[model samples]
Target: MIVETTRPATTRRAARLRGALLWAAVAPGCAWAAVRLGGLDRGPLVQLLAFTPYAAAGSLLPLLLALALRRRGPAVVAALASAALVAVVAPRALPSGQPPAAGPTVRLLTANLLAGAGDAGALVDLVRRHRVDVLAVQEFTPAAEVELQRLGLDGLLPHRQLSPSIGTVGSGLYARFPISAGGVRHNRGGWGFDQAHGTVAVPGAPAIRVESAHPSAPYAVDQVGHWRTDLAAQPPATPGGPLGILAGDFNATLDHGPLRALLDTGYVDAADQVGAGLVGTWGPYDGDWIPPVTIDHVLVDRRIAVRSVAVHRVPGSDHRAVLAELRLPAG
Candidate 1:
């Protein structure tokens, strides 16, 4: 009789312990979901938020654990949180519909040259093989420009608006088509990176303005504010104005608030449109051993049709090059 009584009590304790364990499993994911959905990222949270994709993937484990433990409350919470995160992230993997577009197709490539240390031969080879029409380069340096020209970059892309400096602040735009009214804009609110801009005149389409975007990276806690300011200062896509494309290392991901806010202004991520958004363009290439994340992007006017997007590995650079084939509307 005593054995039976003790067995029942032990079972009760075991059940309680399992329930507690389940709650512990599900709580962190739930909190992350709350913060992400609520857009509560600020200060250090900005940097932490870059790992949302990982968080979303991880939320599944706790969900499965809760279901296995048969903890109803924790399971339900986990399910909801997991669903919310997957809903936001999964769309990037699926192709979105494109608008009806009948115009000339243009191939664009964007790359961060890692302060001009990236392989110039590899870059020019990509341009040549891909038949790229526009090339946006970030972290462009004067030495890099000369080396690229030596490798036949100028022959491939005759028109240019370059602002090549000694460090990561420089940017440039090179085009196969004629480019006019080209210049560089220095960031007023951020770390003052130069953004090279130009108006490209494609033969059969309306003149489109292109900018090589290089926002301040949020590496440090204090630099988060500068990062936000840099993103906010990016030019918006105006329907009535010239069609636009912003490409390069934005130092931000789609999950970031400031980047999302910029996207809200009538711009579309080319990779996301063709379901290639999840591909990482930056990370551990410099021997950091970190997992890659998507930061470099080609954001086009919503009216433009994105046919396909590809990411390529550039030797000696931490960033992968992003190539996008886009169709612009007729003038």
Candidate 2:
């Protein structure tokens, strides 16, 4: 007996509806991947690809929709597309099997204080919890500086280089070891584009050069050049020389051309080296719906190997703080 039971029109329509919805959701993801892969971002469009990595999350929507429709082909296609997105953003999400540097490890935390608006106690608590050896703060302001001191940061780290606030430029670097202040170095745009530099002498290891980098934000059209030029002007974190640690809010991302150039200079982003680069480090500022972005970075010379990385939320600041445990070459 040949029994033919055809599917109902309603079921067919529902399946088509689900498939349509799934494709619609995935369209933007495909577009973002195209822009990222094409490398078409330039000038005003440069920051466009910076947020493409976030689209990786959207890829799951298609898979879910395909499941509702019981469509195996769509499920496979959506999954492959999502995997492609992750592959494109790799090195950020990919693991590096390179062995850690020989000798003791140093934990470092770099954060932007949102013009000293972050919680002093929270920042101090973060330091204590992590037992961070070096702390680099951007947008460091007088109020924030005093609060840190009152919260026992000065007593904890002792050595310091706190600068005066000049727009969103003031920065501070505090360490348990002695710090040789290097004065505020102005970037291409000066004032707001300033970075605080210093040299820190660790117990037995060689001294490390630290910079609280806060280049001018490219949020405005006029600041685009300033941002690019600033990143370009910064020196490379070449190994063999004193281990250089460039950390803080770069206001830039790995997708950014200028930042990629900086990384090409024999320096490696600690977070990126350990699969934590995809984590968002900015957002939730004002009323704007800002998605978290990895604008914060801890760039270390090749001599220093990344051990582990982390990101944390601090009240008051729009950006999250990033920390990395780096193993340095034997002195």
Candidate 3:
């Protein structure tokens, strides 16, 4: 005869507690993804909280969850709650407009014309059509610069600051208004491209400080951490001003930690400000299965009001252009 034995109450309680802890650990990632989906501002703290599990994936959390709670029902429920939170919060964060009463509205266009992109002529046409007030270009080659000038952009926009470094394959800022002082940052990396900043005179309005940055692409976990550190060290060149703007190929998504840090500094993203849906700027050159990412961005300080923001498709570059119209508050 065999005796039937039951597990002790302590064992059952321990298993349940373990399951609850595992579920809690996985819940934050779902919340993070949901925040991004709901268009809520993902700050550095949020990113840190969300990415901890993925960063420490080699540990026991996933393994235990797989062995004990294979169903993942609790995880699914947590993710759904996170998504619902995003839906509730996104609408309220958007900016509200009064009327079109404007003093000087600056229409700026920022583009990352890929180094070898063959669509320079198409880009020129776009500039003329849009009547762009200030144009900030990244991945700007010397050859492209000459071609752009030949296409009559120089005539349209006389004031300019170009750092066509062969070593860096850098950026160029061309403006319709006079540029007071402009220079590239001293920091140099493996890519050799330095950050570019300038002050553009807006006539009756305040001078706007603009920075064109192309930080290293954070494809790996370490790279993402490095980007965060670099961004924190190098702040925008907003010299005692109420208005500042930074626009370029940030090389990171809105969900990324470094980008969130930039947003937390009281600067409003022009795309989010205008309520434009997620605008994907980067695509594979050969058009592969890789999904498009919105690595490009235009962020403005709170004092400067955003009228509208749009992404313009340029023919040759793998990245699209971001156009933003900013309204300065009445004096």
Candidate 4:
């Protein structure tokens, strides 16, 4: 009798311990899902949201553990959390059906040169090999501008609107076609990063306004507000007015609220349209000891059709260049 009674009690204790362990394993994922689904990423969570891809991948481990343990309650919760995250993240790998848009093809490339330290020759080579019609450059410096012009970038892309500074605040836009209304503007409400803008006349298609975007990064708790402001300051795509494109290092991912809000204003991510959205464009390239994430983007108006998108490594820069082949809406 005593032995049997002790056996039952031990089994009960083991069951309780397993229940507690399962909850512990599942809770973090559930919390993360809540934050992401609710779009509650503010302050430090701004930085945290950049790694949502990793978190989405991690949510699976808890799910497997719950299934193996045969804990129905925890398993249900884990499944819900996993489902929510996967629903948001997994579709990025699948291409959306292409809309019917027939127009002249324009090849565009955008790069952040790490305060003008990136290899000018490699950048020029990418422009040449890709037959890039337009180039958006960020973190441009005076010395780097001289280096690029010396490397024959001017010959390849003669029309230019450049704002080269001594630090990472500068931006520029270069085009093979003539660019009118070309100018540079600073984000006055946020960090004063230069954004170069112009209307490119691409032969048979309608003129499209292109801007090199460089929003302030939310690297710290205090800077989150500035980051939000900078992203919000980006001009919205005019579906009714004219064709528009915003390209360069946005410093925020699609998971970010500010960026999503911007996209909701009628822009489509070129890579996302073609199932190349999961490719990482930042981190690891600069020896940061962190996993790569997609932050650099080419956001075109919803009317434009994205043909293909690619990312390339540039030596001496922390960011990889994004090349997008776009079909503009015919005039």
Candidate 5:
């Protein structure tokens, strides 16, 4: 009789275990890949794309397992999934392609004041340290405004465009250069925050259109639609027109479709242009596991070259402050 060659029982069991582990790991990775690629705006599932970076990095674990088990098929699938995720998100980490322009460097600072709870002294110190030419504040309460004036921000900045509110909607723009009143408007059913825009006239340079944006947070299921509309309320950069500078608590990340759409308006986030987009600007002050993410941004006209960008803690506010140094074309 002819004997048939058969694998040992332990080898078969081991192969089954390995295969099980591979699928267990690959399943979650594949789900993330789907959201990242398709961008199906199905609320909760869509939110998972926000952490695609972490998912991309963590997906490699399965690939490693596949290698150890000599599972070629699963290894290939895992490798492709992980590569696609990284490829999609990798652009955010790359520096902008635009060459540095020949212009005066403008130091800008933006922060969320936590409805009068943020530390005015600390903010002032940061401004002084950076020699900021422009400052945009969000969630500026009456108390925060009073504190700023009390703390001599008016003297240092000289010009102001304040839109104070009781809660998260307030904002302000303080600048060393001359700034004309750019009315505080909340045109989106009072759901959008009071965004204060002003024309900043820089000496020997183009007058930059500056705005302070504090759109409603999209944390809850009900608020999600309002949040999208609020972000859309902000006008896109006027093509072939004056360079507009927008900075504040957008409450939306690059992963969010609405925010990405906003960028399609011919503006670029300073942090993204300088390879710091992945570096988050929101987190617990005491360094909790809250997993910091970027929601605050300085969207500038594409003409301006982003030199460098950094984030600092905003006391009393869950959101951090963004500091960006931009090179504007000289007049």
Candidate 6:
């Protein structure tokens, strides 16, 4: 005789509920993981989700699950947790140091001149109008450099360092102040993980250590993982009294883990401190058709005070220029 066996109806119902809730809890996390793994670009939908991956994981994912399961508490709790995590983690990702002074300040301007762009004249005009104290630029092609020099930037920013490799346009740092010493650091092959460091002199203040970096964009899995490892391999800021400021086209957004490591190390974001709006710096040529993203950044140590931050539009480059005014603490 065949024996009939059946599980309890209540137990089966409970198991089904638990499984549904588990999927709901993990769906958004999966999406967030995908984005972190470099699966999305700087489009509107992706940008919005990118800005708040935790929300996607917590709120959106749970809501989607709730629609099918008729449960709201789990989703609400998950969203709150995600939001809290973002709030807690974001500020920590920025560089932190002493606050800025209420007195005189130094102005810095940075841009990534797309190698093929031909509008050096417009860039020169922007530079002249701003009279920036230090100029940190990436994607500096030879022709672009010549045009910039012709526009009088060479005269204005006499002290300069140009990288040897033209591929990825390398990187460049120009300053009105004397550069005691500077050179490229962490030369990763074909990755464009280049950096330029120099010293800036401010009246009545000690020399400040500045570094301009352009890390690889991390288009593939290995690239993204390698970039993160590269960032991790970065040595801690040298022990010195001078404040540290690192600015450049990072090629990654604020949400990425590599950037998060910088912030966690006590770097304060100049734009965030000065309440600068969402200054998307890429895809200017596409107009409303293409989405915008703020991959370029100016991050300072906590000891510095941020006065203002703005993005200046230029004709030739895809990225808008980032200008920031910061005050160093008196010695």
Tell me the tens digit of each residue's lDDT in model 3 across 87-182: 533432465553343558888888887773637787777678888888888888788888888889898889887876543357888889898779
What lDDT does the true structure give each of the candidates? 0.92, 0.80, 0.67, 0.92, 0.83, 0.66
Tens-digit lDDT string for candidate 4 (1-331): 9999999999999999989988999998899899999999898888888888889999899889989988889999999998988888888888887767888999999999989989999999999999999999999999999999999999999999999998889999999999999899797645578999999999888999999999998878888888989999999999898999999999999889899999999999999999999899997654567999999999999999999999999999989999999988787
Question: Per-residue lDDT of 207-285 in model 5, one digit per residue for the tens?
Answer: 8999988887767667777777888888789769987988988877777777888899989989999888898787755
Error of 1 at 311 (Å): 0.0
**Which residue pairs show collisions in model 4?**
none
Best by TM-score: 4
For model 4 the TM-score comes to 0.97
Taking all chains together, each candidate's TM-score versus the true structure is: 0.96, 0.81, 0.73, 0.97, 0.92, 0.75
Model 5 RMSD, rounded to 1 decimal: 2.7
Where model 1 places Cα greater than 4 Å from the true spot, the runs are 1-7, 286-289
- Give the Å shift of residue 159 in candidate 4: 0.4
- Backbone clashes under 3 angstroms, per model: 0, 1, 0, 0, 0, 18
C-alpha RMSD of each candidate structure in angstroms: 1.4, 4.8, 7.0, 1.3, 2.7, 6.5
Candidate 2 least-lDDT 10 residues: 1-10
Per-residue lDDT of candidate 2, residues 124-190 (tens digit): 9999999998999988888888889898998789988778584577888888888885677877663
**Candidate 1, 102-196: lDDT as tens digits:** 88999999999999999999999999999999999999999999999999999999999999999888899999999999999898655679999
Q: What is the lDDT of candidate 2?
A: 0.80
In candidate 1, residue 180 scores what lDDT? 97
| Local lDDT at 102 for model 3 | 51
| TM-score for predicted model 1 compared with the true structure | 0.96
